[model samples]
Target chain A: MTRRATWRRRISRMLLRCLPQLMPADKVDWATAMTREFDYIADDSAALAWTCGCVLTATKMRIIAMVASFTNTPHKNAITSVAVLVVTALAVTLMVVAPRTLTPAGGGMAEGGHVAFWLMYFWPVIMLISYAATTRRGHCLPSGFLLLSLICLYVMQIGTALAVGPAMDALFHAFGANVQAWDTTLKLALLVPPLLTVLQWLALNRLDRTLTVRSMRNDSFAA
Target chain B: MTRQRKASAQTVTVLVELANNSGQWLHGYAISTATGLKSGTLYPVLMRLKESGYLESRWEASPPAGRPPRHLYRITAAGLRYLAATDDDQVSTSAATR
Candidate 1:
């Protein structure tokens, strides 16, 4: 209702909107800090906690699917690995082409283009590193990776504002577009990457919780 | 002087270590480094014990010991009992092996 609250709501919505776009399509495994022997361990309680991915992401879902498949036939590990690769490839294609062909209007040093490029590039690398680490330890991907991504997002946004704000203002003035329009555009562009990163993390966390619940159910039944 | 190989201590050994050093206020960092464990691993174990009322911890007071008040931990009465049970189990296992 208040002006500040209204603005906050708009930003939140904007961020939530972009997160799904940045996320990998297939579920990531929430368990394991590094990739290693994911089979049963000696200590059920500790092993469960370690491998039970506490955060949900598409990566986690994919891991669950793989594990479930492994349960059916351990020999399916190779096939599961291939399936993961195929799914990842498809997701990458979808992300790249699914912007609905919105022609980015270049207003002298396009802010949106720069932000999108960096976010897309950086997010996947972080995800990959995290995936590698948590495989054996069976812990959720380190929170530090997520934190680092956020910091990069913040720095890029500031850089964009300082770089593009002035250029866009001049361009808008020279043309007929209003200064306010350029400001809003620049601000939204700057905000996109960080928002997307947060959304991706939230998705990952959701996957983690779901996996934990499923594991808990199975464990109780087994007991 | 020859450097001794660090003792390969297990979770039970670490618990025993805490029990062995009970009554003496131990700093968290010192315990972690001595045990060759990441803080992440050490903190969680410490937290579980404290929450279960098996361990008690406090911030160390300074002067003479002019260091930052560190988290100091000691085993509780319950913890001592737990340690004794573990000892009994070890003894039984050793006897069975013999």
Candidate 2:
């Protein structure tokens, strides 16, 4: 198979693996449709780009599913929520500190770099929002807005990264310099979304287990 | 599961598909494309429909390929009533008429 086709296939398989969590339906139909869409792309660049977008969209969907399920189950204890909050705080702190350690002496990040730094916190903010959306027992307005904005922001983030990537690469080449901090910063910026998602997946599984046990106990008592 | 929250546009779009198809079994991919719903949006809506007793699904055997069978779905009687009660002709009044 050609390189582009191979890339698309690999990404498609990875995304399909996550489909079962969000989709109750058999995964085969989604897989077939994803493959057809991938194979239909005529150009290599377009195919590769489409693959990236598909991965992001799928991951976002998976997180949203986790949030909904997590919210549906009433928390018998707040330990899980507290644990996630602590981890999120630490993550935010490390994200702020780690990139600075990579900076070349006397060299600093540009304005875009500053923006990216703040944006790296997007995952934490979304995590907080998800917690609020699911855990709270009140009107849904705040959580609803949070959900909508985060989705929009993530889509915009991916779009902006794709659009600015080539220009950033060209500019760096023009500088003809090895910038360690910039390199680390860019990598962290991209990593935030996926890292947050993995955290969500783990939290969901833990809470789900707790929920199941609680329900089982209630059932036994009822019997 | 009987969430009476007003159906979002995407949910209504799905209802339209289930309504139009009536007794016909529609696969997820077909619904996804026809309703312009993403996999993320489409799947959750499907689950809700099932939970609400508005839809039912069964596995349809696949081709010689080793992949798992596909999910075939159809709207239930309650689903038709939902469509009829909340019938928005803009989506497709035919769904209500049926």
Candidate 3:
């Protein structure tokens, strides 16, 4: 019913709809790797999407698998879905609270803005490493390491928020301002890279599809 | 009649079994054995059904007696509806065939 829930459902639906052609499980066995590799090298757009879908699906599966193991229930799908919805809600709340502030200017990168910046930059890497280390991929204990790192990071954020709340207001006053313009600027800077990356990916996919269609047409003409 | 026979004759009898056994958390191994499908074939079908939102699976922890883990699969609400519709169609076709 919340805006966040509505958007999450929308995005999930879009992702699922786009998934069938690109899902990695289309191949029945490991031996299909060679063909998959060749398809990738040939720069097929469909194959690229399939690769992306597979990796995304695998990462999601890993999250569910880990949750299931913890609960000792192979049927933790419903629970995992709830967790994802909660995470999405948290992300929306953070965005609303932060409200597009510019990254604060130089407390030698120890300011509240700097802390937020690092949190955004570093969390995905930790999530991915943990994902790779677990499930059928190999190297198990690294899963523990990944979870530890995440916990440590969350604890540090809590500590910083408590320690810096007063200091941030004081610093804003010292800069002769009542508003936090730096946080807004920093947010814009942080957001641009990912947005650009997504746009570039989509454009590339379109181009690849056009080229594939052209190639197929030429082949038919030659035949 | 012809269509009922075709549907009835389909491998694994998913309709009858599901119609009879709906709502139970069935084991993957049980389904495989009943259907006479190899693990490979059954697993992919299960995975596909899960992806399509027709079924669900959960891992049950090993019992305190220290057995290995097992996954239990169940038909979702959507799957139940699909099975019911298929059963209806089969009944109509069977009557026509008769």
Best by DockQ: 2
Q: Please, what are the lDDT tens digits per residue for candidate 3 over residues A80-135?
A: 43343334334422422332233344424334555555555665564445334432
Find the candidate with the highest lDDT and give its number.
2
As a whole number from 0 to 100, the lDDT of residue A180 in candidate 3 is 53
Q: Over 4 Å off in model 2, which ranges? A: A18-76, A79-223, B1-3, B62-67, B92-98
Instruction: Candidate 1: list runs displaced more than 4 Å.
Output: A1-223, B1-9, B33-41, B63-66, B87-98
Q: Give candidate 3's error at residue A174 in angstroms.
A: 16
Q: Which ten residues in a row have the lowest lDDT in candidate 3 chain A?
A: A26-35
lDDT of 1 at A125: 74
Q: Kindly indicate the candidate among 1 and 2 with the higher lDDT.
A: 2
Superposition error at A183 for model 2 (Å): 25
Regions more than 4 Å wrong, model 3: A1-81, A84-110, A136-153, A160-163, A167-223, B1-92, B95-98
Q: Give lDDT tens digits, candidate 2, residues A79-164.
A: 34434434443445344534344344467853344544666667557655665565343322223443454455445554444333
What ranking emerges by lDDT with the best candidate at the front? 2, 1, 3
Please give the range of 10 consecutive residues that has the lowest summed lDDT in model 2 chain B.
B89-98
lDDT of 1: 0.45
The lDDT for every candidate, in the order shown, is 0.45, 0.56, 0.45
